[model samples]
Target: MPKSLWKIISRTFFFLLIPIILFAEVSGLSHSMMHKMELLVLQLGVIIFVAKGMSILFEKIKIPGVVGELTAGIIIGPYLLGGIPLPGFEHGFFGTYLALNPGATLPVSPELYGIATIASVLLLFMVGLETNFSLFLRLSATGVIVGIAGVIVSFLLGAWTGMLLLDLPFLHPETLFLGVISTATSVGITGRILTERRKMDTPEGVTILAAAVIDDVLGIVLLAVILGMIPVLNDSGQTVNWGYVLRLGAEAIGVWLLFTILGLVLSKRISNFLKIFKGINVPAIMAFGLALLLAGIFEKAGLAMIIGAYVMGLSLSKTDLNYVIQESLKSLYLFAVPVFFVVSGMMVDLSVFSSRTIIFLGLIYTLGAILAKILGCGIPLLFRKFNLLGALRVGFGMAPRAEVALIIAGIGLSTGLLSRDVFGMVIFMSMLTTVSTPPILDSLFKKEKMGTTEELLPAESVVTEFSLPTLETVEFVSAKSLQLFRDEGFFINQMEMGHKYYHIRKNDIFITMICKPNGIYFESSPDDTHYVKTLMYESFVELNEIINDLKDITKPESLKNDFMEGKDDKRVDLRRVLDPGCIRLNLRGSSKKEIIEELVDILDSQYQITDKKGVFEAVWEREQSFSTGMKNGLAIPHARTDNVGAITLAVGIHRKGVNFESLDGEPSRVFVLLLSPKHKTVPHIQILAHIAAVMSKEDAVRKILDCKTPQAVYQFLTESEG
Candidate 1:
């Protein structure tokens, strides 16, 4: 049989067996034992397929693949598409032979339960693995402060809300336990948002992350306390046992501390030990087994299995083996993480929403969740001098409850503190927050520019200062400046008049510029003197040749470099060598073609051209069929072509502007000429974006307009990079 035909036949058989499996499993008779066994195999296979398919679909939509997996469960679960209902054959099946009858009272299959438990534990462990300890350490202090404040505020709000909303007596045990649930911050949701936004390293992001971490710690403690309190609260006539409460607290803390220390120590040794097993073919499986072992230990200690998984992650994080472990776990996470989510969705009772009470609870939960984080976390920022809006933004940023919320809800359900209604409500809240965050953040910071002096400028006392732009800052800079560098190191050195500068020194390259600034006096040691001078001299000569070529073609008297005695006589300042380089050539022509041709002639004459085999092979400009005059009377004409070294840039000032189609459909006044090497121009392109960003600033553009010499333009680009 052809491969395609065989695949079709396999799929057909699988589909056909779905009904057969369902029927045999549902049947309670002895004769259908074989069918029941076959059904089990088929069900597992089908569920896995459905789950993986749904996960892929979710990934395509940019939602977590887990969401899709859960949706898959709903499709195959009893709540939606009914499972097969076998009425007989229970006795004949192996399940019946083993005395494991499939009566209605059998509930869910034990195999399914076991799979779910394993998946849940592994999922939590993966979450632990992803935790960035270095980031946590860097932001530890602020994070702890912010996290604690947020947790306290949210917890208080939740507790208070529960107290006010519940009709039960103030002393009721259930109400208190419910309050504890309300106080929990969904770390999972917050972590996802932090990761997605790439704000995991931001002060605000780090704080939120750290706070969530601490919140989980405290939240678990609170849960234990509340659970313990339940018996006391319910026994109205009995006195509370403070000793037992203290003992439980001590035990919990001792266990947490012991595990944390053990994790820290074990993490140090993990890399070294793993090295010994380097020749082992299944390192991933080994790492996973370790995670399982740790998880089991934590569970045996009466702690949450997820806690153990988290500790395992924390332990491994300190080792070089962390990345390897993370990589190895990717397959499991991809395959099994979705199972947890799907199981979660399968457990959802959709009909619960029809009840007014359930709906009301969900509403209350959502409102409380928002208010809790905002009031809890946001209020403290005011004390730190953040204005109301800033504080609100911070609060709202931390509001969404996700992974942690689900985890907590699961635990609550398993422990019997929360019923299905509460679990469902929490899930609903988690979804609401997760969906609302991106838009909320987008609106809050949409027009907010990054890399302002406040963010980039170093403190006055610091001898050297540097700034790392936020993603928003990078975007703004890219839009406005002609060239930008991200995370590139820059060094500046000043040499005395007679001192020799070398380019070979490891760090002595003078005038080392990365992103925006163009020219400044750079200091280099004698060793690096040659390389630095060569780079600078070559760049300068190349630029000048371009200018001279342009002047030759245009032949405008005003564009000539000759110095006139009175009005035209401008003294050339060598000090301007320390500034960014700029050159402007004026071209006068009757038609656009004449002007462009003259421009091209200048490039061909000026720059030394090298030929290479590739996509962009020669110097040429395209009209782009339209002018790129985006706004503010500026025009950008750019072209990509052959083996050009570095970046060849030219500027033209058309006294009477050309009729290039602007974005506003207006004529352009300024023409900015750009030529990039066909390949390896990504760096040059970044620089061009930086320049555009600079020009987007009205002040910066005006400064460019005031300049007359090539030296002046050089000053702007060089100094800006600084």
Candidate 2:
């Protein structure tokens, strides 16, 4: 079928079926008909499926996936499609028991809400783990000022806007909740944009990130105080006890500060404690156990559970175990986090937006939130190192409010402080800021504008960078260095598996290693600068020794015999990649190197290789490590290199035979060269395995060598294999 036709059919099918699914009259499972567990399981499956689908669809159009997840919830919630009757359920799959409690704002069932609550905790914990504590400290002076200013301005403006528009008092819980929501800035969104633009290392970018971290911390503290105050005001019955309220606020702040300080001070000790488990996942699971325990403690102490989770994560952020826990819990994070966002979105009553007054209030609230960040964060920078342009860049970077804002809004609605209409307004403001800020921020960074007039100060840290020939070499060095560090009493954390990024620490020393396509980059404090250099020196020394051993063992006359007898059994069709233009029947070279070069030249002439020299160097280096010569008069010289954009092949037939260091101590007659993109492994291995299988057949090499023309060679290789 044609791709265009298939696409049209798929589109038409979905277009026609969507309405039926949305408004179907089939009976859905009632709480009495099925166990809550069964219903909850089915509901979760639907939520995850729709959430992931919407996320992918939205990402295709250049919007954030989080927005898509939110939309997924709104689409399928009790207020919309979720309210449609379905099979076994009078209410839809995602329907809530809100009919039992007409005042309930949350649309999901208690079990689903319980899961979303845990998801919120995990999400905030990750936020804290990702926060760079060292960078926060280094930029403390400016960051603290900018962050505090932004929070203060945003809070006041949001509260004022709520009061002016909603006719609420300044001290109303709804008004205060609005202020809390405004104080959040999603640096994750901003950081992604900066990294994509290659501006993450810039002064403005760094300042924005640092300030945003501060914003998160202060915002949480404010949330704690507000949460504490709400009870005091309610109990006082419009005659609040000023002294108790002040004391309650003080206690909240004190408890938060005390836990944070204690956590940071004992973080390394806690890391050591968890390491006692030693099991692959035990340590990560135990760490989460600590988070849960602290979350409960925080709730008991009259603060939000997420605040405790964040504090615990912030403390562990400096430990080498940070990445390990992050890596281990990633599956849980992916599964749980989306549920929280979707549930938050489900709480939005689309019915509330029908009122023009509510819509106008939401629009005005969003505008105020935008300008608040600009005036607050941007104005502070003008008095510091930044010019107006730089300040604006930083301000825009701090404007988006995503996960944290949603979390706060959810809390407000759950606590019954925010009505459905007001909650909708908060979500409306958050979505607008998050969706609008990135493009404006990206545009502001179009022309290069320095954040400072004076030359930026030299970094107080040291970086040992190694630009290896290929990503394979970088990985090789990384694995060796990790082992070496572990032996040296340093805990090693692979930042993200297969990403070639690592964080290693021991005692007072900490180091970060990043692997890019071009090189390995290591950053450390000046105090531990020698560790990176020493580690690399040792890795290269080991590499050299390995190379020397390879040179001794893989010589043409010294290699093992009977290699073809142990051929791979897997079969792959060579015709899909085989090209007649890349095959050469006659080759003038008499040496292994020369023969390989001749084959490479053919591929180059066919425009199959992008970087010829790079491909040559890779092939040569790989050959030096271990010869690719088979025992049955065949040589397959291959390299997975960035020099080729795809799977490329070249066939060269050397009639007189070349000394290609064959396994059976015989000269090689048939040379099959393969070069694949470095990032791909499966296809490279499959093709190599397939070639081995093909050649192991009766008289395969003889049949290939018998060809007189390039077309004959190509046809034989492709046809005989199939």
Candidate 3:
């Protein structure tokens, strides 16, 4: 699996494989119409096997699988293995099918292009399926800033490179195409690195992910807007007209925004429609159907098909059925998506290297790609208080150019907007950037205190670590950001001024953020800590780039050995208190008292509440003291009494709202009554905090409110928040 070994094995295997394929085809050339379908099948089989082998080979060597597949296309295409002349092959047309159409080049076969189009759409569709729409509802400000900065910087750099190309022999608009390519961040490549390093859920990880997703959205939209000028440029000939181009760009942006927003608005209905097919295996078929339909519609409307496909994926991402659909389409995505990349690499004519100017332009473009991400991605992290190392990690992580970039380059090539040399430049730049990112990123992350926490594990427990800067150092960075007081989106939900734990405000028994000169430490009950650590680590990833940007800590330590240290333990769980056993659906209660009484009776009978009367009196007294309603149709009627031996929950949902003297002056339809010993207030408070967080997503609340069965509500509440 070593890189050198993998390279040798792969190169040797492909060297042998291609010659055999060439020999087979030369010996058996058939232009017969009857065997066309058979030929297509043969082509697909060869591509998939070769692509898969190259993909695995590259993956083992720590390169992205997609990059391998793309390279495979180059190796097998007319440029490399395809160049071999076989006996009688000069009179045959086997090479013609694999090449860019032998006799004629213009107006390439729709059948070939159509297959590529399907592959592209499926790739985007998978991209959409994996997208987390919920991230938008509670986006980290740092991520938004980073995403915006990257898009802007990369776009400018790409455009500048294109302008440079204009000074050479390239067309004016082709520079704009380069700019569009520069605007995107390849989410898959960097995301994979973070995941592999076990840093994907950290603050930097989450921020990078959210920012990457956002940038991708922006990138596609930019591609649409830039591509829209094709018709105008085509009609106006080669003359550069700024005014006309600007008008076309504006129109493209406007149209893209209109359709994108429209798609988002209609997403809920789309999810509902798709929900009917939840148990069926046809979701993949349905997903493809939707993607293709939307792609065609967008194409007809003068935008790119991939844009429509991406939007469709985003729309369906909101549904609970999202993962299921993705699973349904896994095989097709693996087999088909690689072809788009392979075919993209196939178009890179190796003969274009004769032009030194083009090669020099490619170098400039690569610089643009590299600097744009580091400056664009890192600057945001620095401002957000991430130290330089973390910023660099993210910057490098976002450095690679893959699917989206390839798609843009392909568009430019097909539209006749870019010369063959320019296309080669784009591919070369992509290949260089893609191949360079991993080691740089690996070193950056490894340079951080990314060792496992086994050395520091307390007692008979195990811990995990993959981070830079102590937890407190992160808190210090977060505190500085909060002090800036320039909020546009959600910041840390809890940060008591100058305190240890931020958002989970009360010094909870579950998890605590500690301030030590050495660094910030997170503590939890010895019996339970893994889930809490995971939650905190995810929050850190939400912090985005603090390690890369954080500075001026009041009390900071090297924290080389203390990040994420913990014992193997299970933390207190809200699910323990709020499960199906104590849950009621479609309650007939007409009043707050009625609902509470009925819920208490269920807890007393099924939940083993021995002192039922005493517990009821304690809870009812608390309810009378003040309405437990938190408004938005939710009420937490909680009480602490010795009568309750353990913390327990009784939840009821009434279709008809009950008047609970709510602060919002609305009837409450959902009630969660908590009963616990007076000493266990921390767990109660923690559960309340979780409930508050869950309710922040109005859709979560709506789903709970509409659940007709207790099991549905329970499932909705307990599923991983991620």
RMSD of each: 18.5, 4.5, 22.5
Any runs in candidate 1 off by more than 4 Å, and if so which? 1-44, 52-66, 83-107, 163-166, 169-177, 183-196, 227-239, 279-281, 385-390, 445-722
Off by over 4 Å in 3: 1-33, 87-94, 97-110, 165-171, 231-251, 354-357, 447-722
Q: On a 0 to 1 TM-score scale, where does candidate 1 land against the true structure?
A: 0.56
The lDDT leader among the candidates is 2
- Each candidate's number of clashing pairs is 75, 13, 31
- Give lDDT per model, in order: 0.56, 0.82, 0.68
All candidates: TM-score: 0.56, 0.86, 0.57
Candidate ordering by lDDT (highest first): 2, 3, 1
Q: Per-residue lDDT of 525-614 in model 3, one digit per residue for the tens? A: 565466545554555665665555565442222321121122212343567776588888767878877888888887877854778788
For candidate 3, the 10 contiguous residues with the lowest summed lDDT are 560-569
Query: Which RMSD does model 1 reach against the true structure?
Result: 18.5
Model 2 gets an lDDT of 0.82
